[model samples]
Target: MTGAPITADRLASLTTYREVVQQPAVWREAAETLAARSDEVAAFLEPLFALPDLRIVLTGAGTSAFAGEVLAPALARTLRRRVDAVATTDIVSNPREMFAEDVPTLLVSFARSGDSPESVAATQLAASCLTSVHQLVITCNPEGQLAREHSGSNSSLVLLMPSATNDRGFAMTSSFTSMLLSAWLALAPDQDPRLAERLAAAAEQVLGRPDELARLTGRPYDRIVYLGSGSLGGLARESALKLLELTAGKVISYYDTPLGFRHGPKAVLKDGTLAVVYLSNDAYTRRYDHDIVEELRAAIGSENVLAVSAQSDDAESWQIDGVSDVDDAVLTLPFVVIAQLLALRFSIALGRTPDNPFPDGEVNRVVQGVTIHPLQP
Candidate 1:
């Protein structure tokens, strides 16, 4: 059965679809929220940057973790500091390995709910382990424990995104993108004046052509591979999770960088696997992406490979026109929408509810059944 365009009425009936469609508007709101508070954010971060031994750790779980992964490379380049993307789950499990006592660390926590046990525990662990640690909580939920606990701290700053970004769906659609944009705008130097407008326009272009991309999800592919480079590689990881989460694990997925895929991960490719490659704008990186697409097309045929690019001469590529001038870092905003739409369509195609793909209580919006262990002093 071929997928169809999700209409207004249909979108209204599903929380996931509604959140997905409402993303562009929320992104603008998030940008405005950050812009109005840029000076305050700068004030909070500037002093930490002045510290000679400062290290920035971007930490979160699941989609939130991927947000840090997407921003870490670009932020490290902009700040000229050692920036690391670490998952809260990992931090909670191995606090000693992830945190050091000598380095003055900035723990930038990204969380949709901010209430996750790992999120709270990781923040506590950082404070306990590092002698000089500052916390920056970027979360959608203002009332979450992470926000309320650190709101008045001298060493912590909690930046709450627009309230609409507190996603109501099982999967994070608006929440993920809004927080990603908020962090990018908050941290990047010489912020683009036209970023909000360009992001909205680019998102609208993708939103208008859902059917074109939805049809691609209708094929009989049991496995999907998402590939990209640098910041886009983090996006590929998020994209893979979206499909896996929205489909309730019915469709197996894998994500890797274009170069990394050739290093044994490409073995996952099979007869029923569909490969989605996000081509980079960097001249050097684009060559690797293009070569992978060519090689995949030859191996699995064009029907199984989908190439998403801002500028590509390939006839089979999904060219996102008019945004070629945007930097690949910022372009991640619209590029992610393609993955969101595919997950929604694939969920429907598999006879699963996108809003709650796993109604049996196997997985949840906020993770369950996790025990936080006391760190040994």
Candidate 2:
């Protein structure tokens, strides 16, 4: 018998799964909107930046947390802020180490729902224990309790991402990229908003070529590794997680920084492995990213590899032009869309439903069964 049909509503909601073929415009709008607000956010954050000893904490769970992973390095280098991506689960379990005393912290929280137990708890923990803690929440859900935390309080700022990011399906597709873009722009407002414009245009261009991605995803591969440098390193982690989650573990996945991949993780690449590398546009960073790709290509083979980049100049790379002229923050969307589409295509090809890949339900849209504990002084 033929399999059940994927309904139009289901297909529409699948856009929320992060497939590049779906809703690229939503991704673009998010990048543009966040970039346009860079100045306003930077102005609000000037005092925090002025503090020489301030600690910038980026907190979230799953993909939300990965957004921080992508932003931490970029923020550290650009804004000169001491930043770290701490999972809320870790923060709630051990508060002292995550929030050290005498540290003036600006907690940048990324949340899709803003209602997760750990997300709300992390915010409360920061407020209760840290005397000089401030918050800048970037989330898709406007009604999320986390968003309301800043209401009537100048001490907190919440930037609601594009409405579409409040992804209806289980997986966090657009929400992740949109929140990441907001935090990046929040750090670099002086850059041109057109960067975001070009990025959105680029994403649309990539989405136009779903058949190209389909060919890649349709290929037979049992293992996947995503490599990136700087902010894109975190993007690698998120991409790996998406493939693993959506495929229900049929495909093993890994993520690492470009330079860090040579350490001991290179052993995972086999004859049938699909390895993806994120090439940076910056000349300096690109050297490291491209060198690794060249080394890996010679070690493995070109047929089993894919390279995503801002420029198509590299003959072997999937040229995603436009974002190179923009800041890394604005470029994040197109880069992430590539990963999202790969995960979705892989899921469908593997005979798993993209909406609910894990039929046994080991994971859900909002995580469950966690006990909330109050932070103790």
Candidate 3:
């Protein structure tokens, strides 16, 4: 369990995770498809994106919400457009607060199953209340209600992600990352051609060196902190969730930005703790990020610190090479690839199934026992 176990069953489980590790390829496929549909998305989205009074809203729940978290900041920076990632849970309860009739709005919804109550409800409510609104639906379950409900509305676009991303276990391991990558491809087409290749290589690199991450996870850590900045923050949050969910609350996990963590959250770095820092590739950002990490190294004596970055901060840095020219936004894959591997190794350390890390059913693959409610009048 300390290394990449190559048993048939474990290897099978690793298959989905390995495929997910190839997220750069997945992103490439999504980008290529989106490119092919550029005319369609453009002809359809140009005016909507160009609206003088337009707001682009990204909505989802759980890890799906994290997808938007990763894309929103990067999109705003690159596209220079007003974009936001809001949870469907928030939108369903407070439509007026999230929507406005004064502006043309486009709601980009990410759903793993597309059947989540809030997913459909939020979509319906937005259409019902907003004067000019469009829907961009991304989901794994093409047969789910969200995909089926699209009525050829000129404003609606439903894109299906890869099949391996449609996870069947109680946790969204691959599916979550896949959907998130899909959005990145859809939103940023001009990044770099080598981005996907670098990510694919990173996947193989991490999987090949699984023992390294597995050994780190095998440590006795009661508290874990994931520190990141920019789009990588979303990946940090997801990584923290994976450890928490897979371990069934045995290991407490929290996610925060590098600078933000020093404020008060850093108090969690007690003995038997793990700190995972995701440093940015942007020259200035990484400098600040590494500075914060250096601070942690000096003060957090008892906690084990693991730093992942596209460039080397010091000898301790886990260099995610081959992503030199790739935008840090797209280069996020290497850090995420490493984080996912860490989570899996941690699951093994805790003697749990990486496939279904949650044994008591507190967390689930598609989520469960929730009624998909209708929009309240």
Compose the digit string of candidate 3's lDDT tens values, residues 1-377.
Answer: 23334343564565446555556566556656666776776677777767766788999988888878888888887778788889998888888888755478889999889988789888998988888888999898888889889747777998887765667655565566667666776666565655555576765665677666656766677778898888888878888987777666667889999888878887887777778888887787787788878887887652378887666547787776766556555566566777676665666666777776666766666656776556456
Better candidate by lDDT, 2 or 3: 2
The alpha-carbon lDDT assigned to residue 190 of candidate 2 equals 63
- lDDT (CA) per prediction: 0.88, 0.79, 0.74
Question: What does candidate 1's lDDT look like per residue over 1-377, in tens digits?
Answer: 33454455775788888788888898888888888987889999899889877999999999999999998988888888889999999999989999855599999999999999999999999989988999999999988999999999999999898898899889988888988888888777787787877887888888898667756776788999999999999999999999999999988989999899999998998898899999987788899999999999999999889899888577889887777866677788889999998888888877789988989999999998999989877
Q: What lDDT is obtained when candidate 1 is compared to the true structure?
A: 0.88
- Pairwise lDDT winner, candidates 1 and 2: 1
Candidate 1 clash figure, as a count: 0
Q: Which portions of model 3 miss their true places by more than 4 Å? A: 1-25, 301-303, 371-377
User: Per-residue lDDT of 202-289 in model 2, one digit per residue for the tens?
Assistant: 8887777767776777677888999988777888888899899878888899999888888998889887788899888778888898
Top candidate by lDDT: 1
Candidate 2's TM-score: 0.91
The number of clashing residue pairs in each candidate reads 0, 0, 3
Stretches of candidate 1 off by over 4 Å are: 1-8
Residue 50 Cα positional deviation in candidate 3, in Å, after optimal superposition? 2.0
Quote the positional error of residue 72 for candidate 3 in Å: 0.6
Q: Relative to the unseen true structure, what is the C-alpha lDDT of residue 18 in candidate 3, on a scale of 0 to 100?
A: 59
Over 4 Å off in model 2, which ranges? 1-24, 31-43
